[model samples]
Structures are given as structure tokens and as C-alpha cells.
Target: MSPLPTDAPILPLSQTVSAQRPGDAPALVAALERCRAEDGAFAYSAGREIGTFRIEARTLNELAQRLAGVTAVAAVALETGPIAIQPCWTPGRLAEAEHRLGSADGGTGDFAVVRLRIVPRRSGEGNIFETEFAGPPEIDALNAAVARGVARASAEGVEGEGRIIDTRVVFIDGAFHPKRSTPAGFEEAAIAAMRAACRTAGLRRLEPLMEIEIMAERDHVLPVVNDLATRGGSELRRRLAQKGVAIAAELPLRAFLTYEGDLAALTQARAKIIGEPQLARWAEVRRR
Candidate 1:
């Protein structure tokens, strides 16, 4: 694949007011806050948590590098709309620039940032940010390409990969070849950048968990609840239904390894289990 130019800038998003046009500040901030707050649950899968943020700096490679140094961050992407900020920032450079430019003179350009944590899973506990971006048609296409690539790579998330497939990466900035820059090229770049960030930030294993509801005959309630307990599942709510007991629980995906068969054996295939995507949490890091 062709290499991204050395000078390709990855800018940090800023939440600043626009002097003329409605700076992407308000809508961007609203979107980011909403996403972060509501990022509590998802129906799909992808790598890592996704967030959007407003851009303040012109370039983010330095900032990303600094974040990678945090030892807990796994990866970071500052993007929304068609533009994306490649993983490249260094904290030292940003600090130096800030010191040199001073607060008032230091310009926080207009853009959005997306931060991804690699080590510790937030488990729907902490705040996840969000942002929005507007760019040319090419930018939109580039963002789509990045999404498609990441999704394809993460397709096995629910199939027992033990990873989330909901990695949200969008374009914040890049160099386009016009003739040479196809979605494939840009997609490779996006994935490469994220992987690079992960390497720098470190990776941790996290398992996708499911929020499940099970309905069974009255006679089977005790047995089913026992089964859940054995598999590390938690019974959240239980009520008597018209014909049986209704059970709500939280279960790790791994427990499903024999769940289908076990449920059949325990309830004689008469029990119903409803599964929905739930927040992911950190698990023991698997050693190679």
C-alpha cells in the first residue's frame, strides 16, 4: 500500500464559537454529549468505544501520542462527518505550542475529537464523548470507507471474538490523491493509524456481555436461576408471568458457550431467552 505522507496533519477538534457561520461548536457539542451519555448500550458490535468531540487544535498527532503515553488509553480517533484526525499527536508538542502561543493567541481551530480507551473498559460507567463533522463529498466517502473496513474486520465480534465491533472512526483530515486515493487506500490508512495507536496505548481484553431475559415454566424458575448463577450470570428482575416465571439477567457472552444446550436440557426447550447487546467490560488479559 502507498504510505501516508510524513507531513499529513492529524488535527485535534476544538469547541469554539464561529465568528461568522454557526461554528460546528453547538451541534458538535450536543452530538458528542448525547452520544457519550447515551453510549450506555448498543445493538451492534465493533472495536473499542466510540466518542465524538469538538476540535480545538490544528493538529492532533502530538496529542494522540501524549494520550498513548497515558498507559491506559488503547487508541484515539478525532473525527466526525467526512474528516478524521489520524492517530499522531504527541503531548509534549501540544504543551510546547500552548506555552509558546499563550491562551488567547493559541488558536483552537474548528474540528471534533474522538477518544478511544484501550486498557480499561468503561462498562457504561464513565462518560463517553461525541462530535460531528461536515466536509466535502470526498470526506464523507472516506469516512464511510473507514467504517466499512473497521466493520468488516470486526465482523466476528458477536461470533465469539470477545471484542466489540462498534469502533467509530471518521475522517477529520487526510491527503487525498484524487486519482489514486480510493476507499481501499484510505481504509488501510484508517486501520493502520488505529492499530498504531493501540500499539502505543497498549491493549486489554474485554468481553461483550448480553442483557438477557428468560421466560420459563414455574417449575423451571429455580433451576434456571441456579443455572445462571453457576455461569456467573446475575438475575436482575424476576416476576411471575401468566404461565411461568419471567427472569431478567446479565450474562457474559462466554456463558453462552453451552447456554443453548443447557437451556434446552434444563427447561426441555420450553424456556425463552432474549438477548440484547450490553456494555463491555474488562476481562483478564490473555497472555500470548
Candidate 2:
């Protein structure tokens, strides 16, 4: 799936869907219907299909903080409990918590660091908290806990690894202690709760595929169609006329951008093209 602008806000589904030109995107509608058949939900906003990476606690804290570094990622949300905190958090108590968690360093004692940030609701109705946790580099104690929690989140219906769907995090509760509260201990609790809640929320991965309708001269049609395939484009349907051919195809979002301009040049500006986003399957990103 394509990433959204990292600093941009995610609008609610209702509003986003409402803004779309309903009947104009039959391919998108069909794709979404297929996703529904697979028990998936639409998670589009600002003309892009949104996907989230499930970050386990074993990864470096630097990696956690660098999630936003991906240029395509519109924003990173810490799915803590019922709260979905965005990167553009307000300067308040939640921000304070996030800053504190981010500044915490590991290596001195039996400590773990969990970065937290306060976020507003997608509807702009309210606020909730989200956080990420990390433990010692050499510890295996928290691995099972993190896995279990991620599994729980997946069960709750998040578009784990890959899929065409909505994304979110859920939390229930966690335990901590002043004397013996190890970072590993808190991390286990956090991961589990977050994952379970994600399932409950029904987050699914949705790949961003472009549904393009193009009309080109009869002679140029063969060359045009061949070009599309090389860029991961798949022809879904085609229509022929006296002088031109009208075809619909699905292509990866990134490939579509470059091909759009190329199509114009290939057709000598004779091709008519219209594109809309459609959902495809989810793809899990296997981390090393």
C-alpha cells in the first residue's frame, strides 16, 4: 500500500468516502467489495490507501523513532490501548509523555523505554494516547510477550504484515511496579494489549493499486498495453471502437506515476487516461 504524507492528518472514513465521486470509480468500488468479502475494511484518505507496519519491541529504539522517516508514510501512530496517537501531537501532557519516553536511554539498569504520544481521534472528536516500548538488546525474556501481543493485534483485525484494509492499535491494560518493573515486563504487557485491541478494531492492510482507463489509437494499443505490463500493470477489461481501444488496468501506485507520463508520449498525446485507486491484496513485509 502507498504511504500517506507523514505530517498530514487522516480524515475519518465517512468524510473521506463522502468526498469521493461515488459512481465514477467502479473499479475501486469493486475492489473494496472484494475486500469486504475477505472481511476487510476501506482505509483510504486523501487519495491514498493507508497501511501500517507492525513494529515489534525487539527492533532498535532508533528504528521506532525513524518510522516517520519513510517519505511516503503520512504519519506514524502508536496504537496504545484505545488511543491512536499521531506524530503531530499537541504540545501537552501526552506530548510530555512522548518526549520523556523518547529521551529515556537504556544500558545502565534493568530498564525498558516505551515512547508515548497523545493523538486526536480520526474524526477530530477527542484524544487518546499511543506508545511504543523497547527492552534490553540481549534479552529474550520479552520476545514471546511481543509475539503474543502482535498476534493478538492481528486477531483483532489489523491489516498485519500485508493485505488491503484499515489499520489501528488497541490496548486494554498493563501492570507496572516501582521496585521491580523491568522494561521487559512492561514491554510484554504493552505489546499484548496493543495487538489484541488492534484485532478488535479490525485493522487490515490494503495495497494501493491504480485502476486506469485509457483510450488509444488502434495501432498504438498493442505497444501501450505491453508497456503497462512491465510496470506490474494487469489488464482487467478492454473495449474496442472504430479508431481506438478503451482498456482498464490495475498497476502498482508507484509504477503508475511514471507510466502516466510515458503513456502520453507513447500515444503522441492521443490517449485519454483516467485513474482511480483500487484495493488489492495485503503483503506482509518480512523483516530481518
Q: Pick the candidate with the highest TM-score.
A: 1
- The lDDT of model 2 is 0.39
Write the residue-wise lDDT of candidate 2 on 203-226 in tens digits: 323333557788888888788778
**Candidate 1: segments with Cα more than 4 A from true spot:** 1-141, 156-163, 177-180, 198-227, 241-246, 256-288
TM-scores of all candidate predictions against the true structure: 0.35, 0.33
Give candidate 2's TM-score: 0.33
Question: What is the Cα-based lDDT of residue 7 in candidate 2?
Answer: 22
Q: List model 1 lDDT by residue over 85-200, tens digit each.
A: 11211111101000011122333422212222222223433211121333667766655655554333333222223223223332334444344446665555544444444445
lDDT of 1: 0.42
Instruction: Give stretches of model 2 more than 4 Å off.
Output: 1-207, 275-288
